[model samples]
Target chain A: MVLNSHQRATIEAAAARIIPADHDPGALEAGVIDYIEQTLATHDGDHAQSYFDGVRELDELARRQFAAEEFSSLGPEQQDRILKLLEEKASPFFSLLVRHTMEGFYGDPRHGGNKDRAGWTMLGFPGPSYPKGYSSPLGWYDGHLPDDFASPKKRSDHEPE
Target chain B: MSRNEAVDVCIIGAGASGLVAAKELSEAGLSVVILERGPWRQRSDFAPEDEISTKRRHFFWPTVEQEPRTWRLNAQSPTEFLSADVQVFSNAMCVGGGTVHYSGLSWRFHESDFRVKSTDGSVAGTSIEDWPISYEDMEPYYEKAEWTIGISGKGWSNPFDPPRRRDYPVPPVARNSAGAILENGCRALGLHPFPTPMAILSRPYDGRPGCVNKGFCSGYGCPVGAKSSALEALLPKALATGRCDIRPLVMAREISVDSGGRAAGVVYIDSAGTEQFQSARLILLAAGGVETPRLLLLSKSSRFPEGVGNSSGLVGKNLMLHAPGPIVIAIFPEAVDGHQGSPCTRVMQDFYKTDSRRGFIRGGFVHPRAHGGDPVDYALQPVHGARWGLKHKDSMRESWRHYLHSHCTGESLPVESNMVDLDPEVKDRFGLPVARITYTSHENDIRLGSFLAKRSREIFEAVKASKVIVPPSRLRKLHNHQMGTCRMGNSPGSSVVDKWCRSHDMPNLFIIDASVFVTSGGLNPALTIEANAFRVCDYIVSEARRGNLG
Candidate 1:
């Protein structure tokens, strides 16, 4: 409810470019737009004005540069080109967009983003398992210490003066 | 709007020191009241797996917006309010304070740490003072604190560790991939590596379960009471004593003094926004380093115009935040799976002394850390050189499992210019002036940090890391390990508190926290703070028994 349909579309397109879908789910599929919208409506409500201004500016730039009706109407390649230009210019809006995109894609699914634990799944993270913690020999390196490993000799060569 | 009957003792902050003091004093049959500014969170309230809430957001309460602290590089620079996510100088305002979200690296300062000035001689532009008390005086209490609070580690494993009378309460936590790799590399290089002494339960001890290796430590509270925070180890005992009354969500505004220039009580704002006064015969200020001095400065009165116990004009001077040493991130071919246990398992203290050959007076410890598993934190790191698109994603997938960081923590020389004072303008939600911090790391700290970073790189190289990334060194802002604001010394003209941690100007007022630290050692300060609290509380109990604490 914090953003109109046009604003939402523009932000979703922007987030999609920031974390495009390939073999795995990306920002759009992970519901990054919903996360951004919810954040704007709540804790980060103060930045809503800047977000609106940024979205409008992005649309304006898309039309002026690519002859598109809006940023979302542009092809993936054109969207990427505009994003790269914004990045090169060190645009504050672009930085904010990228930061929010990452948060939505990587943050916990409880926040309405990273839907179905898509981010955790991609990273092979088993989320928060509190009551049940893992035992030692957690990885290949720990279980397979070098074959010639020996108990370290107690040496004071580097002892403090 | 309300006045409460006098208690035997009134302590501000239900933190590491205050809670310990409460348990000790109340057990000795003294009626005590503790005022904590944040909510008393239960174990169930902690979400160990949610990085966004626990790590990204200020899950510790009193976010920067709620109580803003302004900071500047030095007196000449303009102060800026710190952001919510800036980890620098951020302390949890909850019942356990920073211990609630701490990494549990418990350290006993070496003998040389107490006499830094004597050991290293004078460093120009720094106020390196020897502690009024020595390690020998603190050793017994250190033993007491470890046993009472449940520390887990092998005694004398760290050859650089100070002499101790007894071993830890429990054995060390099991080592993970990062620790094993670091051990191998360190042994190859002839460096000493030991299991880190931690304040977490390795096995079930004192009715608390052992850590589950949930990979959600440091910034997150233990959901299973595995972490031996003051909240878990001390507060419950204090409450059971039936003489310790903990009032959470109560902000102490000022330490009120009697007309005779003696400590009287504390004036605080209760949860319902009502002003209340709770009279006490004795007062203990354990509000950590910054807030302890800020509270002292806020307690200005006609009898003590320069603020209570600040006649020496050193109430907030000689601030020392432990130097943020460099971190070396390495990527190996095989997965480290760092998310299987606590971030740190092994520590190298080979350089934890004054080594002139290293081009720095004080040295630091290096530890291989397993803190790279969090997706949000991992993605936010700019080491990949790509901000977005397929390249960034590709790098993330490739490097997420293989990354391990070797972190160094060094000693920060106490500088007189670095200080905490009442801000000239900004105020908190209580309408009181906020604490303004002016700080800049000493040159020696930077030298030591960079030197340790190179050592870390050597360790990584020895382990055959595919890539070792050492970021450019930058000036550190205030870190979490704050110390030396209200210094303790033998001379009343040079320090705020006496060797017993009692205020020099007031007989009945005591400060039992890191604020009383004479010098910051090259390690975490939680254990020392707890030990000092025990020693100070013992003195308080004996004084109360003799009717000498008026």
Candidate 2:
């Protein structure tokens, strides 16, 4: 609700390009925009002005470069071009956008992002193993340790009886 | 304004040391009052499943705006106010303090660690001093702390470890993939690697459940009461005595002195923002390294113009923060699955001692990090060189489960210039001057860090890692391992506290935290802090019994 529908569309488009969907779901499908909006409304309210300014700048740059109506109307390749230019200029808004997009895509689902654990599923991560930790020989490397592995020295040598 | 009746002891900060002292004094039949600046959080309050809620939300610590700290390289450099996520010598402010969220790498300082001055001789421009107490003197208390607060490890496993009277209460936790790989690599190089000593429960001891390998050990509190924080282990006993009162959300503003120039009581702000005073016979400060010295500097009176314990003018000098070395990340062909156990399961202390041949007076330890498997943190890492687009997403998939990281923790020599002092400008939410830290790592620390980084690279190479990335060594702005603001010594002229950790100026004022450490050893300091608290409280109890404390 902090951003207008037009501004939200532009941000969603930028986020999609940053983590575009391939074989697996990306930022858009993971609801990264919701995370960004929720954060801007709450903990990161100070960054709200910058977000509005950045979205307007993105639209202006897209229209100037690609003869587009707005940034959200641009093709994927055109959007990538504008983002790269912003990155090359070391734009503060671009930096913020990238950081928040990654946070939303990868952060926990409780933050209004990573919907249905799509981001975790993409990386094959079994999210948050609390209340149930794995036992010994957790993975291939530990399971394959040789039987002749060296053991630690005996404590009985120094400890009192 | 409100006033409370006089108590036998008034302790500030319900942290690791304070909680231990509370249990000790209250059990010995003394009335105690503990004032904590933050809320008392239970195990259930921790959100292990949400990284945003636990790690990124400043859940354990205060926001940068709430308690801002300024930092500069040295007096010559311009000070920069740090952000919340920056390493600013911040510790958890809640009941158990940093122990609630620490990785639990419980280690006793090596024998040579105490006699740094005698062993290494004088290092130029450093205040490295031998501890008034020795390892032999601390051995019994170390054993007491390990048994009483549940540590799990195989004793004598680390050859470099100092002599001990007893083994750990429980065996070591299970090894994860990263630990296994590191262990194999270390053995290939003929170096010894042992199971890391942890404060977490391995098999149920002292009524707590054993670790299920919940994987979120370092930053998140144990939701199942498996981590042996002071909250789970010690404070319960203190409260059960019915003589101890833990007042949370109350900030101690100053240590008030009597007209006779002796110790008196404390003035604090209650949770409702009301000014209040609590009188006591004894005033103990365990408010961590930074806050402990800050409080001492703030408690100024006409009887003690330079602050209660500032007569020596060394109250806040000789600050030592353990320098974190290069973090080397390696990508292997196989899945490491590092996020299944404690943050670390194996540690190499082969390089822990001082080796003159290495071009550094002291050395550091290298260990395999279990944090590489964390999704959000790993994705945020700049190792891939690509910020966004298909390349970034592809790199995440390729390295998510296939990478492991190695870390080195080195000692920072105590430099007189690197210290905590009151900032002339910045103030906190309470309208009090914030602590300004001026630090520059000693040359020895830089040399030690680079040496350990090379060792870590070799270990990763031994395991046939496809790619190894060693980030350039950068100065750590600050570290969680804060030490040596009010160092302990034999003479009042050079140190704040004496061998018994009593303030040299105020006999009834004791400091039982890492602030009293004479030297910052090359290891995690939680176990040592707990042991020293036990030792100091024993001294206090003995003195009280003999009628010498009045």
**Steric clashes per prediction:** 1, 0
Tens-digit lDDT string for candidate 1 (B1-550): 5899899999999989999999999999999999999999999999867877777767884577788888899999989987665543477889999888888989999999999999998989999999999999999999999999999888988888889888999887767778877888888899888888888898899999988777777788888899999999999999999999999999999999888888889999999999999999999999989899999999998777889999999998988987767668888888888888877777789999887887779877888888736777778788886889888888888888888877788899999999999999999999999989898999898888888888888888888889999987655666778899999999999999999999999999999999999889989999999999999999998888888986
Docking class for model 1 is medium
| lDDT tens digits, residue span A67-114, model 1 | 888999999999999988889999888988888788899887777789
Candidate 2 chain B least-lDDT 10 residues: B82-91
> Can you tell me which runs of candidate 2 are displaced by over 4 Å?
A147-161, B87-89
Q: Chain A TM-scores, one per candidate? A: 0.87, 0.90
TM-scores computed on chain B for all candidates: 0.98, 0.98
